[model samples]
Target: MTVIGFLKKTVAVPVALAMTLGMAQADTIRIALAETPSDEMAAFFVALERAKANGLDYEWTAFSDEELAIQAVLSGQMDIGFGTPYAAMQKSKAPLRIIFQLSKLKFFPVTSKKYETLADLDGEPILLHSRGGGTDSIANVIEEKVGMKFGERSYVPGSSNRVVALVAGQAEATILDLSNTNKIMEQHPDMFNVLEMFEVEASDEALFANLDWIQANEEDVQIFVDALYTTWRDMNADPTIISKETNPDGPIGQLPPEILGSLDDFYTAAVKGGLYDPEGGGMKAAQADMEWYSEAGQLEGDPASLNIDDFWYMAPLEAAKAK
Candidate 1:
């Protein structure tokens, strides 16, 4: 071969290999998650572990709160996020869509032994997770039901932090979800009591993505969603599956030894407390959440008018159901 032709062929081969490598690199997806270990994120974590085994490259970003996670997904910093802040979704400039409904958070009004019911919280101080999170929204509903307003409420960013505040008598009452509530009740059964607040079902944690990103990576998106629903089915069928699959080196595995060891029991109690769905499809609870939030003026639009089809893409869930 002529020298010029040989050089041309070598350059073309290297360019082609570079393009292939770039395409492979572009296929990677990043998922963001809130810090809490509720059932809402169980399926995603399971799918992530499975995806690693299947040669799917991905990474995760965990935020201290749901709002931050939602903001990260909205800002395009993450391709997918676990929590769908519905109020933020309605107001964001960039279009976002819910691809999967993970689970509903059944928040309970927990208080010191001095309070027996929501009515007793007429002038009591409350510690909330944050100003406008799931816990705060639930508190709004309780105030309406009991015809009392929360006094001297404070925002403690982490649920564990809020629990600490309650334990140390920094706050007399607070609304907490099942996971933290379980931990608190177990550790100090005599110190606190959970005031049943008629079950506020307004907020659901969902899997969401930017619309443009989903369109750009449809196949990978489909695969990720498929893995998610399959994992959901497996988790709902047997909640212990995730606890069993918890990698000693993975994020869940790296939790404090005490938290890691009690995860199975925690899972069992959460499910029993109606924090998780054994069937994995909690559309009814999701619908109820929409209504409750709308009633609380947290969401501007009509819940009934909001199209369920627009909110969630059921294709992956349907595929998992068929399997």
Candidate 2:
């Protein structure tokens, strides 16, 4: 899957920030991030700090979007990336496979007061994060379940920006993550409605890499996954653990005091919302993703017929659980 050839000309070499961690080892793992660092990444950074303490050296570059991050890994420019690159994997038939499930499809369909329920918004224009991103896939499943198709689809990059668009009357219907959804509703409860959405347990964000790379870097990969497993378990048990463990000198900690201050509130809400799976979402998540993505038109063939191992390498996660 030479996705590099096309992207190499367009995708700029992502500027690596001063986010490197651990002792400078001979082999530093290159990580491709889908978005700029923010509150949502605090837990991940905490896990990285844990892995760093265990001698897992690494550096990360923030890509403009998830596609670029996936391409960076697929092209061998980076060893691993953050995203749910199901479409890319299916299209390129690359040996790219997900190792850890970062978060589930916990998005909410928010709309103006003109719509009270999902059915009322039939044939309405909808704003989404990207053409083939998590929001678009959620919209696909919504249409399938609600028995109605949207009128027009528009693309907007960020959930906060989409909420702004809704507030400014640019678009009435859109999907948003838990944090943004809660913010908009709390701020202006009278102006909008969070329509009832069907339950979705599919992987929304995940850590994926090429299988060959995983095999060659098994040690570092195991350390990273083990840290993630432990951090996720601790976060589920006590959501405030993320804020307490955040390094004041790190990227997440460098954000504005407002965001840093609310880390506890955000993570507490996220945990109660069932955003992260304590077990790292190995086989169960792989199976749910097959069904969800297939229904959303990201993958071909029957979901039951698809091989889970083709999209997920579960050994590291299995070892994490064993220990």
Candidate 3:
């Protein structure tokens, strides 16, 4: 997929300041991420820089995983979180509302030369990310769709860790994100092969916030949303903007030089894969997310029964796109 091709086809903030709400603190919007810092989030940080330029005060913290991130947001320790804990939010009746769909699930099940197909791994052990992560969710769907189930499950949070484990003979099979998959195949041309998997119209990340906070900070939220949408459009139009805004002292630059070499290739694949949504503010993406999660058994009952109003708040996103 050419970068320009995606650009040709696709057409696609902050308030938390000076508030005397129930919690007493500074005005920055407290944001939380489900995972530690990595290159995937570089462009988001660039958007935050843009938001700062617009005088939106914000700060973010990273949780060990999405589960914790959701908890933080529900407890109001953070104003917003970067993950989709749909089931948990529904069960708890948490006032969380998804404001942005960050990225689609563009994962691949990859393994060493020993396994050539998904059916070949019926009794083999597989290494994956956390139980509810993107790779893990894809594996769940693969099992149902292909009528095959692996033998054992091992959890290793990062794709790079799983890749290292596969190479070190600690595991025979694992699921990886696109960039990691590319890096593995590039390094050991004959060692690993990606198993064919069906496309999952699922979201890997989203921006969600407590309903009350969003209502109170509408204008600021719109500013942040608009900044993020602009970031996606800008980055898609020129992949080099990612590298341009990458702070040398920041997370992306701190990655090993070898991983940095694959940065351009990674974004190239992302654009081709349609990982970033062109219009992220509507029910279209949310509907797909619901269906995918329901199919994966991550949510209970029929997806059609899940009301969009319960899970999403699209006004800010819609307003952002209008700008």
Candidate 1 yields a Cα-based lDDT of: 0.66
lDDT of model 1 at position 180: 83
Candidate scoring better on TM-score of 1 and 2: 2
lDDT of 1 by residue, 1-323 (tens): 11111110111122112222212136667666666443334445667777666556675545566676677777776677766566776777877777666666677788899999888888778887765666777777777767888888687766677889899988878877678887799999999999876854444567788777887887777676667666766766677877788666655665677776667776666666665543344466457767877766577787888766555555555555576
**Candidate 1 stretches greater than 4 Å from native:** 1-25, 36-43, 201-203, 278-286
Residue 131's lDDT within candidate 2 is: 76
- After superposition, the stretches of candidate 2 with alpha carbons farther than 4 Å from their true spots are 1-26
Model 1, residue pairs in steric clash: 202-289
Q: After superposition, how far is residue 142 of candidate 2 from its true place, in Å?
A: 1.0
Predicted structure with the largest TM-score when compared to the true one: 2
Best by lDDT: 2
Candidate 1, residue 129: how far the Cα is off, in Å: 2.1
Ranking by lDDT: 2, 3, 1
- Clash count per candidate: 1, 0, 4
Q: How large an RMSD does model 2 have? A: 5.7
lDDT of 2 by residue, 1-323 (tens): 11111111112233342122222234677778877788888999999989988988777777766777777787777788998888888888679889999999999999999898998878989998777778989989888988999989998767878989999999999999999899999999999999988899999889999998899899999999999999999999999999999989778877899999999999999999999999999998999999999999999999999988889999999999999
Clashing pairs in 2: none
Error of 1 at 103 (Å): 2.3
